[model samples]
Each structure stands twice: as C-alpha cells, then as structure tokens.
Target: MRRLSETEVRAAVRGGVSRDGEISRPLENDATAIKCFGCGQMEYRAREVCRCGYYLRGQLEAERQRNADDYLSRERNRFNQLRKRRNISLVAFILALFLGGLYVTGNLTMIGDTLARYAFLVSVVFVFGSLKIIRELERQMVELSKRLN
Candidate 1:
C-alpha cells in the first residue's frame, strides 16, 4: 500500500472524499479530523487507530484509567496523612486543655503565680491553634474524599 503524502493526509482530514466518493464523518464542526496521540499528526477520525499503532479507543481508555488510578492513590495517601496529623493535633489540644485547667484551678502550684499564668495563656493559644489546624485539615480531608468519590 502506498503511504499518503502530508498534503493528501491533510486533505483527507479536511473532509476530502475517498475514491468511493463517500464523505467522511466530521469529528468537529465542519471538519472530519483526528489528531494522532503517538506522533501528533492529523488523521481522519474514521481510522480505527493511528499509523503509529496507538489504538484509539482501547489504549486511550487504558491511559485514562491509569491516570485516574494514580490520582486517586495520591489523594488517598494525602487523606491518610491528614488524618494522622488531625489525630496528633487533637491529642495536643486535649493536653493543652488539661494543663491549662490544672493551672487555672491551682492544682499545679510548683510554678510561680506569674509563670503559671503565662503558661496557662500559652496553653490557651496552643489549644486554639491546634483547633484551627485540625479544622483546616478536616476540611481538606473532606474535600479530598469528595473528589475520590
């Protein structure tokens, strides 16, 4: 079989009729064209596969599935990491609350009054910061889960 010249290929892509005089089906508006994924060349959409042997339907679907699987795996890892961090932050927030409560109730009396007050204030700040971080991480995990679904 003779290979088509570039001009001939372009003409066929542009809806030129074959020897049988049958008009090619247009892929887009008024143009019957397909771009080859392997070599980045134009071809008629009626062809089953590109000249470079990239099966249009099957290989394209496989590629899309691979991409989706990769994306989901990355997102799942990220979600797991976020869950771990959120658990850590929850533990920190609880510890900060416990220490702050002890200081406030005078149960931790070894420290000076001013130092205890400062420590309690610092613990309060830590608790709020941890809460903010946990909230943000939870929001992110929720968004990731939605995407995964």
Candidate 2:
C-alpha cells in the first residue's frame, strides 16, 4: 500500500477522506487520533496494532533507523572527499615549498635567473593557495565531526 503524505494523514485522522474517495463520518478531534503508517487507516495513538495488524511502534522505529543510517552514510562520504582534497593540498604545499627553497638557494641552475624568479613566484602562489585550501578543508572536516558527534 502507498504511504500517505503528512497532509493526507492529517485529513485521514480528521475523517476527511476514505479509500473509496468518499466523505467518511468525521471523527472527534482528540490528542489520541493518529493515522497508521502501514494501511493509512485512522487509529488511536494509544493503540500499538492497527486493525490490519500493523505494528505502529515497530514501523516508527524502523523509519528512524533508516533515516539515521542514510545520514551517517552521507556524512561519511563527505568526510572522505574532504580528506582526499586535504591530502592533495598537503602534497602540493610540500612540493611548492621544496621548489621555492631550491630557487632561493640557486640550486636549480639550469633555468635562467629571470625564469628562476618567475618559478619562485609561481611556487609562492601555489604555496599560499594550497595552505588556504588545506585550512578550508580542515574547517569543513571539523564541522562534519561535530555534526557526527
């Protein structure tokens, strides 16, 4: 059986509609009135089983568990992506540092002085860019960790 939407469920509890698309006798609006998730039938909240033998409590618990599982999987995927990006940024930062150091010490002599200066400038830019990316990824990971906890 198809599940009812929230509005439809409320209407069902209010005796607004029936499965045959006919107006049913309106039920008294009480705190205990609720619609069953299994058969989409009006039922009392205090009752555990509906007329169709569907256990409301069990269905509710199962739905909650499914939602929690989905949330955890999504968060885990996001965390893994962030970790990969952070790792790539860290590697880039280290490489840029090494290149900049080589240029500064004049250890890379095959390149002309002007080319070496340009290379150093590019490496400096890469270093700062990588640092910024790493910081942002760290912040995101921290936020994900907080949410998970």
Candidate 3:
C-alpha cells in the first residue's frame, strides 16, 4: 500500500529487491529505499540524497495517516475553541446591531454610523480566530515533514 520510487520498485519487480522487500523489512534507507508511504528520513547515496532512505512511501503514508489523524484531532479542538469565541462575538455583534437598528429607526442622537464600526470590529475578531487555527495547522504540517527527514 506504499508508493515507491521507480528504481526500488523496479528492483522489486526484477526480483533484485532485497529479502526486506518480501518480509516488508523496512530498509534503514530513507525516502529513496522504497515507495512505502510510511517512510521517513531522507535517503542519500554517495553523499547525495538520490538513493538515500528509500523515501519509504509506505512508512511515510502511515506517518501521514497518523499525522492526519493528529491534525484532525487538533482541528477539532481548534474548531471548538473558535466556535465558542464566535458565539460570544456574534452575540455581541447582534446586540450592537440591535442598538444600531433602534437608533436608526428612532430619532436623532444619530448613532447609526456606529453600526459600521461595530461590524468592522466583529469581522476583525472572526478573521483573527480563523487565522490562528490556520497557523496551528501549518505548524503541524512542518513537524510531520520532519519525521521523514
């Protein structure tokens, strides 16, 4: 279920593959060794990464699945947090709107213009919360990449 490089795969096809290939013995090799998605650590050969660790697509895949799971978990957490914040902000925004509406419909004191200001504030708060979640997810991505290195 792993993706492998053409060479390693060719080796496996040619029966030139190592016994490790049969037993699914993950080579100490990195991303260059096999196509296992579960691979980590960049592979290198003769001072170059070309033939390095096999870039285990198998292991990398597994790791990615795990990372994806973790990411989902984190996303759930962030979603909850943002939902709570948004609920509170939305309530405040609604209250602001109500007041603005009352002023507009009623007489002067002309606070109608304040409605735009309140709306701007609410939007900013929501945007900031969303960006925070995005930033967190990106950080997770970077850490996952390191596992394969």
- Which candidate has the top score in lDDT? 2
Q: lDDT (0-100) at residue 112 of candidate 3? A: 50
- In candidate 1, stretches whose alpha carbon ends up further than 4 angstroms from where it belongs are 1-48, 52-54
Cα deviation of 94 in candidate 1 (Å)?
Answer: 0.6
Of the candidates shown, which would achieve the greatest TM-score relative to the real structure?
A: 2
lDDT of 1 by residue, 44-67 (tens): 665778777876666556766999
Tell me how far the alpha carbon of residue 130 in candidate 3 is from the true structure, in angstroms, after superposition: 14
Candidate 1 lDDT score relative to the true structure: 0.78
Question: Which pairs clash inside model 1?
Answer: none
Report lDDT (Cα) of residue 117, candidate 3. 57
TM-score of each: 0.65, 0.69, 0.31
Tens digit of per-residue lDDT, candidate 3, span 1-149: 45677777776666543544342333454343434223433232223222343434455567679988898777667656655665565565556556545555554244455665565556556556655665565565456446534
Off by over 4 Å in 2: 1-19, 22-49
Angstrom error at residue 142, model 3? 26
lDDT of each: 0.78, 0.81, 0.52
Tens digit per residue, CA lDDT, model 2, 11-34: 876665554443332233544556
